[model samples]
Target chain A: MTVPALSVQGLTTHFFTRAGVVKAVDGVSFDLAQGEIMGLVGESGSGKTVTGFSLLGLVDPPGRIVEGSIKLNGTELTTLSGSALRARRGREISMIFQDPIATLNPLLTIGQQMQLAIAAHERLGKRAALARCTELLTQVGIPSAEARLRAYPHEFSGGMRQRVAIAIALLHRPAVLVADEPTTALDVSIQAQILLQMRELAAETGTAMIWISHDLAVVSSLATKLAVMYAGKIVEQGPTAALLRDPRHPYTAGLIASLPAMTTPGTPLTQIRGTTPSLLSLPPGCPFAPRCDKQTEACVQKPAMTLDGPRGWRCFHPVGQTAGAPT
Target chain B: MLGFIIQRFIQAVGVMAVMSVIVFFGVYAIGNPIDIVIPPDATQEIRLEAIRRLGLDRPLYEQYFTFLANLLQGDLGRSFVYNMPVLELIGGRLPATLELVLISVISATVLGVSLGIYAGYRPDSWVSKTIMAVSVLGFSVPSFWVGLILILFFAVHLGWLPAGGRGDTVMIWGVAWSFPTLNGLSHIALPAVNLALFKLAMMIRLARAGTREIMLTDTIKFARAAGLSEATILRRHLLKLISIPIITVFGLELGSTLAFAVVTETIFSWPGVGKLIIDSIAVLDRPVMVAYLILVAFLFVTINFVIDLVFALIDPRVRDGASA
Candidate 1:
């Protein structure tokens, strides 16, 4: 079989604070083929963003990747350092942030920031870089791209700034694009437009993308594969359509049940009881065990990530088992 | 932009106008200058002549109007002690003070900002801590005491520099500058450094805080993720982001430096306006004192105006506000 575009195995990132060690991403693993989109769904503090940061070696001090192997097309990234890693960052892998304004420098115009990103990895003259930037803006559905190049970050509205951020990320057609909730900050209509554009861009560029978001609906519409994380670990992983239709993990099933559309119109929405466990002091065995309705005596010990074909889950008693079905 | 500048100019004029009235009345409120001008044993006729000649006999309101009208006519009146035009006295000394302030401000900003960036970039490092410690000392120590200490080390003990006074100078555009000469530079160095220490410390703290804040911003992180080198990221993003605070501090500090150069000038006996003002205040020279106050007020308003313009130019958000 052809090598996957990006493969991560046993990735564990921990943050050492004065209070305690936070296992932000604990033994998470996944693979993405070329041009595929993997939705990483999780609540706040679930280590989804940390996982993205770790892939690019962007984790700051007090937070570090303890054990992990990140491979991009057969080349190991975790072992690289200094210029070696930096060389691959924008050219091979890039990221889109949650806030577009934060991603774009306020002092710099769109063309200047885009040119800097492009020139960081490639040698291009001014005029040529501008031409390429204008084209990228156009591809991102920004009209009057040439004129917009002179506009500063503050000049663009929230949605437009996000589009500019996306255009910048796609400038070099990186092999792997990690988008950390790129559309979550936009209005619903703007969100849909950006999501559609992102899907089209990923397909056209043939770039593997890990779309991290808490919104399952957006992820379901955009992601080909889905990985549901809870308390720093992935509870379930499978094809999006299949996983949404039948989530074997109790947490995944609870998330689907909590969606407003899943219940009858007048009935109160179902919510999973208890909040997500703190990463600094998780419960023994599975981090989600305290909140899992299907927990069993076996759950007192953490279950290994069990793989069945393309599907994987970490739980002693999954929801799909007939005996564990809820009345 | 033009309209904004014009509006600021009008505001500056209004400020100066109000300041002139306050300075005029404030100087009069201080014990009468005539007391110092004429001896107590002098006859009543001599006292009356002195009061009439000095325009002290006029009502406070009329004297203020006359002062304002004379100010418009480029007259700052005559100094009671020196028996010369206050404008000429100030003009002669203005260059020296400006020279000292210019050198001090430039040196302080460059040294402070560079050190601050280095320290702020790695705040936990031992070197940063050491720099911070030194900066704290710079801030806490009084300028006069620091001046004496500098004199003790560089002049009295090592004999490497002069302790006071303006040294040899060359004229540029009819103005004598103390640069490009060993003697002049060495003479100005001690006083300039003494004046700069407090401002330098303040600048370091401002720059450090600004740099720390900017480093954590999302754009900086994006720049890092874009594979830009640390130096490039600093120059392109961090420096620009921190520049607003630095410029603001520089402007305010420069104004205060000009306003409060008395201590440093006295310590070094530098023939700047600060020293002149101190001597005039001693003799109760009303014209000199009043002229000095107005000049300082004008300098402050002008500096703020310039800073506002520069601020708008640097930050697009401010520029947008200005146009809107």
Candidate 2:
């Protein structure tokens, strides 16, 4: 079998606070093929971003990857030293941030930042690096790419700044790209444009991407596969189209139902009923059992991920399984 | 950019004009200097002659106008204490003060910023904690006390350096300077460090705060995500981000150092304008006092102007905002 571009298994990241251990990403597992896009969907604090940070070994103190194996192209990244991990970061796995302006240094020109990124990974001459940077900017649909290189971050509009950020991420053409809500801060129209560009670029470069966002609509259109997270664990995972049409987990169902389009125009929009439980004092069994309508005595005990071919879910009484039957 | 600078220059001129008026009127409001200068046994004619010659017999407005006119003609009046032109007296003292302020500022900034970067980078480390503790002491201790302590330890106890005064004299381009000799350096060292302690502490705190704040910012995270090494991140992102605040503090501190060097100079018996100001104030030397205040104000405005220009040059946002 061909090795996946990125493979993560039993990934558990925890934060040791004064109160207790907060399991930000507990027993999460996923796989991505080259050129595939996986939408890591969650509410705020659902550990989507933490999972991304963990993959890059970017988690700071008080938080650590307690247990996990993140293998990229069959190379175990968790076992690598800091310098080795840094070497692989921009060269093999790069990230684009939510706020593009934050991703860029305001004092530096676009050219200077791009050159620094280039120089970090490669020893290209100044002329070659500028040429490469210009090409990447052009690829991202920036007009007057060469002239725009001299412009600082503030000179560009919000949308253009995001494009610059995306271009910088793509400069090295890393094997995997982690985009942490890269477009959520942008205008809707600009978001659509960036989404379209990213999809095309991913295909062209065969770069596997993990796009983390709270917006399901954008992810539904962009990603081929989807993983729904609830209270720090992947509650459901499957093909995006299949999962959206027939969601197995109640949380997934509620998320789908809560979409404004799912409800009749005159009626109120459906909501998930309760907020996500705090990571500090999550219930012993299932994290989402408190809010789930389908919860039973069996749910009080954590349900191990039950897989049926490629699709899987962590619920004892899933939607499609013997509806209303007592276990 | 040019327009912005010109506008700032005009604003500075207006500020200096307003300050001159305040200093002129405020000095005159104090007890008349003639009372201190002329003896009580002097005849009425002698007193009248002294008052007229000193421009004190004229109406306040007339004196102010005369002062402004003399200022326009590049004259700061004559010092009653020294019986010399106020400008000449200030000119004689300006170089020593400049040298002291310059040396102190450079030493403080380099040491403070370097130490601050280290502390901020590893805030949880013991070294950082120790530096922070020392900085707290640096901020709280009075400069005069610090100057005394420095003299006691380095000069008195160790007998390694001189206790006070600008040492040897050198003339270069017809301008007298404290020669860059060992004795000269030793004499200036104690006072300069004493003058620099508080500002050094402030710079360290500012730099530490600035660094810590910048480290948490998203741009720095992005730089890390982009695979830039820690050193690269520090150089490219952290340093640049912290620089604006450091520069601002440095500029303001430079002005304060010149203004407040009175304590340090007096402690070390260093001959600077600060010492001159203290002496003039005691003797009610109005011309010297007024000239010094106005000169310090001008220096402050000029420093701020330069800082703003630097801000514009370093940050394009400022540059764009200025042009806009």
Candidate 3:
């Protein structure tokens, strides 16, 4: 097997709130190899986003990695201090925020903002940083990067601003890029353009990527491997093609069926029946059992992720034709 | 830009006209100058003669036009109290006040901004907390109260410095080779500090809010991700974000500072326009009061104009709005 570029072992994050402790990402684990795009697919409360944040140590106050081991190229990240982790961030890894508007400062000129970006890690002269900023802006397909440099955030359209943000993330050329739904906020056409550019950039840079999204359609098109998360745990993991063609877990099967498939054009789309279990008060047994069609009475005892044949899944009983059922 | 300026000029003229009318009627319509200066026992004839002397008995419109015409010629009527040309009296006191105001604003901006940046970057630290607490106390307590506190402890109790005044007239100017300039500066420092600390509190609170909000943005996080040193981000990002708000507050505050200077100038016995305006108020020297008010109003209007111009220069979006 190819050595994984990143391995998240027994990764867990919990939050203490007024209600109770939230197991946002409970014992989640996955691996990504070099130059491979891993899709982390889940619903809003499934902890997919939280898992990505944990890998980067970007979880804000009150939410923390309670138990986990994140090894980025075999180096433990959980032990890194704030300064050390910051050093690792742009040099080795970068994350794209969900909202482009909330990301760029409204008051600053794009050139000045980009200058800070380049000068942050390198001790280059002002002119050199400016030159690099122009290069990166141009690389991200901004029209007239030179003229656009002097423009403020409000001056640009939403698509253009997101492009600028993408340039900022790519300027340092980090080894691993975590895009938490980068194109989720854009219009359909702009979304396609941005995703195409992102895919091209990833291939060119040969960077390992974790594309976190709720829409299976977007990730299935871009990622080489797919990991389906239920509640706070990974319910299934396999090659993207295999998972899409033959999902091993009932939850994953439900997810595939829910998509608006061309093969069943007139038929009503399949969507998971029940709500995701709350991390704060998860039901004993499989978190997805309440929503699972093939769950058994034994599912109430709780099931741990177990390997089924060649894939991994966390289900007490599979969908008969599927493998990797949790036991 | 030229069009924006012309628009502002028109607005300034209208505002000044309205303000002048209020000053004229607010002071004149309240009571007779004769009743104020002479006894209530005085006869109507005496009051009428007093009113005629002050040019209050003329047709209201004629009086206004004559006042406006004289204003065009820089001739405000003679002060009833000072018994001198209103313009000339202002000229005499103006330099002292101008000097005090310039000193206060300069000192306040430097001290306030430096402290504000420090307080903003480390909100949770003791340095930030202490500054925040001090800022609250500084804002709530009156400027004059702080002035009294300084004079009591430093000038009276400690005897570490001279109490007040610009200086003995002999030492006012002339050749200062040694610490003479230093001594003059030392004399101004107490009152200047008194003026500055309160304004400092205001700027600090403003900066803290601006910085906190800026810090939350993606750009700040992106900059940090670049592994750029904290100092670099502060110098480049934090300060730049701060300039827009600081410049805005500075412009408006610059205008009001002239008005506030009166209070500070009076407390420390520092000679400035503020003190001159106050003296003119005590005697109902209407013309002098009117001239000073107009002079102050003029300064405010010009400062605002310049501020808008700067906003246009730094940001193009403002340019469009200013024209519109």
Tens-place lDDT digits, model 3, residues B174-281: 321212356666677787788777778888888888888777676676666556667877877788777778888887776787665876777788776688778877
On the 0 to 100 scale, the lDDT of residue A164 in model 2 is 94
Off by over 4 Å in 3: A1-3, A16-20, A125-131, A262-268, A308-310, A321-327, B35-54, B102-121, B168-180
Q: Better model by lDDT, 1 or 3?
A: 1
For candidate 1, the lDDT comes to 0.90
DockQ of each: 0.77, 0.80, 0.45
Residue-level error in angstroms, candidate 3, position A9? 2.6
Model 2 interface CAPRI class: high
Fnat per predicted structure, each in turn: 0.74, 0.80, 0.51
Tell me how far the alpha carbon of residue B30 in candidate 1 is from the true structure, in angstroms, after superposition.
Answer: 0.8
lDDT of 1 by residue, B55-110 (tens): 88889899888988999999999999989999888888888898899999999999
Superior by lDDT: candidate 2 or candidate 3: 2
Q: Which pairs clash (backbone N, Cα, C closer than 3 Å) in model 1?
A: none
Cα deviation at B188, candidate 1, in Å, is 1.0
lDDT for each residue of candidate 2 in A62-140, tens digit (9 for 90 to 100): 8999998999999999989999999988889989899887889999999999988888899998889989999999999
Residue pairs that clash (backbone atoms under 3 angstroms), model 2: none
Candidate maximizing lDDT: 2
Better of 2 and 3 by TM-score: 2
**Model 2, span B171-270: residue lDDT tens:** 7666557747667777788888888888889989999999989898889888888899999999888888999989999999899888768998898888
